[model samples]
Target: MTAKLADKYGPWGVVAGGSDGVGAAFAHRIAAAGINVVLVARRVPVLEACADEIRAEHGVDVRTVALDLSASDAVARLVDATADVEVGLFVYNAGADDISVPFLDKDVDTHLSLVRRNCGAVLEAAYRFGGPMVERERGGVVLVTSGAAWAGGASLAAYGATKAFDLVLAESLWAEWRGHNVDVLSLVLGMTDTPSLRRTLAAKGDAAPDGIATPDDVAETALRHLGDGPTWIHGAGDPTGPSPLGALPRRDAVLAMSRSWAEE
Candidate 1:
């Protein structure tokens, strides 16, 4: 499966927010599958370290591009950084909500930042990267999103909204690009055990959260199932089935989601 992915969407893969957690795991796994990787992140040291590690472990070429995805010119910078490489895969994996407070509790700027990065940047990335893939006739894209997108919940207003955007975007792209041989996946996730998740949990005063998914398993599963998407819900009983709350009334769903946030 790995070798096939490499050959079909081979040469290079770009991972936005590729420095740590699920993004980092995706980089390593992609590299292992014989694809050279270009890792982008705001943290230079961590990005370079991840690149170096992937190069050493997978014996594949690796490059690091240090840039904040939330920056206004980030997508342009990313396009420039990888202009020389024949990048065939892209993973927009950086939309982590470090603070899960009530909507009004957070500053408006922070909400805007999330919107820019999660929706605006992701859309631009698809336009830029997917353009080349369409012309070349093969590629893959994974947009990592969350279950928070399924419904509105207290403390999840902006964050969940952006994730919902990603979910819709990925599915729409898959519909448009399927016949063109460009695979697009909306990779939906639950609470995963990752550095970013741990930090958020600790910040929220929870030292350890039970039932967290492992990053390695999550990445491996996504990589192995890249072809089976529009939406692929990780650890789901039915990855392609309707949302778990799809049957519930909107009010009930919202209330249930609100309670879940309280538990978190």
Candidate 2:
């Protein structure tokens, strides 16, 4: 598996938001496949620590780039930092909205920041990294999204919109790049067991529900299915199937989504 992955998408991989949780899991898994990794995140200490652990555990070269993906120049900085490497695999996993509140409750700046990170940065990374992959005719790109993307809901407006953008972007890229042998997956996650999710739940005086997906499982599933392009629903019975809400009317789907948030 290691040699095969290295041959196909190897040399080096880049994991944005790789300091912890799903991003860290991706870095570890990629390293285990005998690929060097560049881990990018805003938290310097955590990022370095994750890098060190990957180096120790997998004996793969690990580079840390402390960067805030929300920044306008984040992808430019990332390209500069990684210009020396042949990045055959790129995973954009940084867009997790911790604030689940009514749209008007949060200021415009907060929403804008989310947009910049989730939509702008994702698009930039995919274009810059995926272009080379297509030219080389081999590589993989994973865009981490969420089930919230299936429909709009109260308190999930901005986040869902951005994730929906990611979903369509990944699918479109897959269609365009499939002939080039470059795989693109929009990883749609439901309730996942991650520090970010834990914190968000705790803020609401709640705990993680049973059967929530694990970061390692999600990462493993994605790596295994890198060739299964377009989209992958992490915990769904039919991973490549249409959304569960697909049959419903748009208004009904939105109402269902709103109720789910209210229950949570």
Candidate 3:
């Protein structure tokens, strides 16, 4: 049978960075599963387009807010924008990688942007939304950290470090909020077929992976595991891999697999 999630997480959901890539996928899938979705992103047209598509397809309520989460008051702004909503699922999927130049060759602005985007924004959103979810005593959170969180690499040093922070942040929040019935998960995602990935790789003179997953694949997995409690490597690899918590995932196993297929 095709996997399906119970509707416990429906009624309302928030997709941060919902205008692109896996975040859009999550927004669509959740709406398809009978959830009202609120999409947050910097681009209005893209965000509105996604919301419109989901609403047309699933006949569910869809809302959009265009804001750059890396801005100084992003969390406060997000809270203000979503003040009237009750979110049952929160997906933090927005992030950025620094220009892939040698660390010393990178400008201070690019470095600061990376930190604010990856670490500051994520942390701020989590605390603002997460606290309310806990007070309500039911909800799920998914942080889209990367498999690059596993190791320190020369080309991916800044990105990897930021992802590593995301991983630990999810775990710590999960532990702290367990008693309040809030589920927290770290999705140590492997390479997936997305526009951003394609653009990034192409810019680097690289090709896309052979067996990359669609955004729908990852979104479906996220739904099925919602409220399953704190989980690490919550979703990894393609659909061919084991389901979340079905088996203990090895960091090396995914890294080796991704590296073998990554663009040259």
The best-first sequence of candidates by lDDT reads 2, 1, 3
What TM-score does candidate 2 get on C-alpha atoms? 0.99
Better of 1 and 3 by lDDT: 1
Tens digits of per-residue lDDT for model 1, 113-197: 9999999999999999999999988999999999999999999999999999999999999999999999999999999988888
Report the lDDT tens digits of candidate 3 across residue range 26-59.
8888777777888999878888888888989989
Clashes of each: 0, 0, 0
Worst 10 residues of 2 by lDDT: 1-10
Worst 10-residue lDDT window, candidate 3: 1-10
Rank list by TM-score: 2, 1, 3
Runs off by more than 4 Å, candidate 3: 1-7, 232-264
Tell me the alpha-carbon RMSD of every candidate: 0.9, 0.7, 4.5
Best by TM-score: 2
lDDT of each: 0.92, 0.94, 0.76
Q: Model 1 TM-score?
A: 0.98
TM-score, candidate 3, is: 0.85
Query: Whole-model lDDT for model 1 versus the true structure?
Result: 0.92
lDDT of 2 by residue, 1-264 (tens): 567889999999999999899999999999999999999998888999999999999999998889899999999999999999999999999989986999999999999999999999999999999999999999999999999999999999999999999999999999999999999999999988999999999999999998889999999999999889789999899999989999999999999999998998
Q: List the residue pairs that clash in candidate 3.
A: none
